[model samples]
Target: MTVDPFAKGGLHQAEAILKAHGVDAYFRSMAARTGDSHAVIDGRKVMLAGSNDYLGLSTHPAVIEAAVNAARRLGTSAGGSRALSGTLDLHGELEERIAAFLGQEAAVVTTTGFQANLALSALLGRSDIAFLDARVHASLLEAARLGWGRVRRYRHLDTAHLRELLAAAPDDAGRLVVTDGMFSMDGDVADLRALRDAADDFGAKLIVDAAHDMGVLGNRGAGLAEHCEVEDGLDLITATFSKAFASIGGVLAGPAGNVHYLRSNARSILFSAALPPASAAAALAALTVVETEPERRTRTLDLAEGLHNGLRTLGFDTRPSTTPIVPVRFADLAAGGAFWAALFRAGVFTNLVAAPAIPGGGAMLRLTLTANHDETHLATVLEAFDTAGRRLGVPRGPDLPPVRLTRGDGRRAGRR
Candidate 1:
């Protein structure tokens, strides 16, 4: 009897684990959202603690109006590839706005964030050796694999390891270093200034995927490069509009000459349909909001700090996260599943990350906060966590001082 190739493969183990844990919750859908903080899931109202809408601009009046106006004027779709007939004045305007916001000479917009990375890897990696951080996003890893260059991974956030690898390379060989500004799963930030210095010393071009940092970090919300005051040192910066911009597209910004070259040569942009008019309009409007409303960024960081402290005080291990994205560490896969289910039942929603997303036998609950989440919403989430922690009998760490929530006036107050 011949063996069936489709019968089993690498996914069998994961499938078994999912079955054991009741796969119902993994892909559950939300029926509707009342606002940025609340969503209807399985006919129950649950606080949204797993979203990436850092600035809560998705439902903002100005953004919605811009999208609506674009749709009414230009319709929903860009009918062809950007290289063909898909280029719109709106697209050009959005690119210019993004380049100005990021303090870059030029910018190229792609259909998705993954495509931006893929284009870079396929184009640049062909001639250069790609040195990537071990914990970089999977899209970057896949892109490196597809590129013609030899790929090497340095230890996560270890500039020393990166420098060693760079030094060991042939003197004439071209080099490219890639990393994420904010690691998605762990929510820890990269030391961009150190990385920039190392890359400069080794004559390697640096690419930073700032998807999670955009609209949340930096003095003006240009992302981690600006946050680290290294904007001028980076060779290239890429980010997604899906998170903070409340739109669907990706942007790659750099020197004018390099960006022009990619506009003509990048296969993804040359062959794929252009970003929709509504998305471009929405992103432009969102950028305006990010620039004008500094308080939103302040509120988001404050909320994340409060939540992280609250979790730690309750004996839960929240990894070192100084941003709006927080990860609650679990002992193992089973424990994570149980905790997630409990949280769901308690009217709180979170993303369960396990196995392939995180190495080893560990798991975590990815809880993201947005600027629109108010004090009431946070209090309910904290209460839900306390109840779930007790019910699950999860181990706690040393008790710390109580965390204080920031008041409406921007002062820290109300310790619990």
Candidate 2:
């Protein structure tokens, strides 16, 4: 592969790689979205099984009104970074509310979920060790490399491996055990209990990026840490508003001292423009709804659970996932692409997770559910997947785990 994107030599190789895997159904334009569960893609209305709008607050009347009011009053862009003149009353309001909701002593808002992790650079010392799960999000891995720290990986979901890695690190070194609260691809949650215990044993802090867990888990919709009853055991938590808040922004919450330090020292926050007023207002309103409407999260998980079981009964290898994010595995990338194409043709839309997105160079279909989805939608989607499975001759097998990328092999981190 060439080092340049515009170099002529790289063009054919890039096209050939994508074309060989039948990767044409992705990145299509969509118009006239009705709600969280339906959208018009390519001039056709389809059931959206690929969306992350778990609570369906994107279409909530209150959220829309708040955004409209904020945009009308403050204009669109923040106009500058938060360290300068971009900070608004709306930012403080949202930050305070989020901090309280997450049970953190303080919080700082960022422009995107990626930046939230990048902000960790301000806290990691050169003598620190960041122990990560092999399947942790790419943002965390990149942050560890770019920040002042040494990175080490353990087997995904294998607490024993994490403990071993921690035990082998320098005793006097600062340590941080990092993981995604709910994995975006596999849709399973980390064992927070195990993580907390391991970190405590090694005198390490716990950093959880609950991008997929916030507003969708726990009795109060806090996240996996709360759902697993380990919230008080963790040191830091980060989350995004894009998924359930129906807005765009990121938040980093922790002790008051750490948050204040990052707010002052993090390059990502100091250089990047603050989150727009409309986005912040929308997240604030969505948070209110998320607090009042617990049934939405319940409906989302119910739909996902039913869909997971239905796919399994149809002989598809859907990992036992209890979250709104469900993954259906396939024999290979070609099969996954063909199935995704077939589903689109059948008026269903889904996301494809192909190598090096996951290990073994195969593909996985990421099926998500939202509060707006109903039993009717779930039944229709299951039928489409069942039809596609029989038609493509994939996802039909005994349950098994895929072989994973070896430690420190960053290719499996998903460039896609």
Candidate 3:
């Protein structure tokens, strides 16, 4: 009667397979901290090649100080849900700060990025249709399922497919187009201008999940809309502070009326507890750093470029990456596990993305770069990868079936 999915199902089988391949890299608890960019795993000081701390501000003195100060001043928790007694001054300040930063009329903070995406629950009516990108985060998919709207999935980063789907929808149907600013695993960017054109032509509201892009891209660090110069074209933008901001919370920013509507009707935000004061303060501090320190983002992207080129030179397939996230494709799951084990031995830790996370049955090493990582770190990582591949006899890049480019945008790929 008490069946555990992880113990008895597909995940279990995958675990067995990984174990057979001698991969001990899956879930090691962090025992000690070696700054934001490095972690002590199994007592070995390894660099975090798979972390989401893009700007590496998690360990910044200012960010930590702000969190500590807030905790000291205002207790730990928010004490209640936003709809109840949980709303705090720090929350409002962060919301305002985020709204201004993103050039939005208003913003509402949520406890998690997943919950922030659930704002669609309030916006998607029974007669509405949600056009989703295939490579979007699972949160948006869950939101579409929870909402009253019908969901239609288009190819990842493919505005042409999105346009076709939109054209097929009922003319009177409320259209909501959803996509990621930067795909988490693929590391590719959405052509916002092209997407905006498609949405506008089809009379749709555009919603972007900029979880990986916020505080990482754009000249002003406002995420994809700003980076693509389509801020005015977007109807709503949702993102988490966990990545580049080095904080723990999410925000939904858009028009004043839309935000107010979501705040009032989105059950995910209304019923759930509000973000803690410490998180809010830390996010505020991180935002300040993100604004003042443009070099962090520049360094981050540049490092990613260098690392990506290095991987290519080593014959690893980094698929369609234009962001800090780079995923190296492998022949199969077993090859990936062996590579992971080898990298772990080499004192570099990277995440392994396998089936379920992806549509097709394959594995990829999903590594992300941060601003704090330098040339030395890059060299170490590249060297480790080289050793792992050569020793494991792993299949290299451009040899696999590439995501065929359909349009001139060069970002059109992904399917179910």
Q: How close is every model to the real structure, measured as TM-score?
A: 0.93, 0.91, 0.93
List model 3 lDDT by residue over 1-416, tens digit each. 98875664555567778888777656679887666488887778888899999888999899999999999999999999998999999999999999999989999999989999987878788999999999789999999989998999998877889989999999889999999988888878888888888989999999999998888777788887886778777889999999898889889999998899899999999899899999999999999999898888777877877787788788877767766788887768888888888888888889987877776888888997788889999999999998878887887656433232211112332311
RMSD in angstroms between candidate 1 and the native structure over all alpha carbons: 3.5
lDDT of each: 0.83, 0.83, 0.85
Model 2, span 277-333: residue lDDT tens: 999999999999999998887788778767777776777766645466778887766
Q: Over the full model, what C-alpha lDDT does candidate 1 score relative to the true structure?
A: 0.83
The residue-level lDDT of candidate 1 at 388 comes to 86
Q: Number of the top candidate by lDDT?
A: 3
- If the candidates were sorted by their lDDT against the true structure, best first, what order would they fall in? 3, 1, 2
From the highest TM-score down, the ranking of the candidates is 3, 1, 2
lDDT-wise, the better of 2 and 3 is 3
lDDT of 3 at 111: 95
Candidate 1 lDDT by residue in tens digits, 189-270: 7888889899999999899999989888877888878767787888888889999999999999988877887788878778
Q: Considering only N, C-alpha and C atoms within 3 Å, which residue pairs clash in candidate 3?
A: none
Worst 10 residues of 2 by lDDT: 407-416
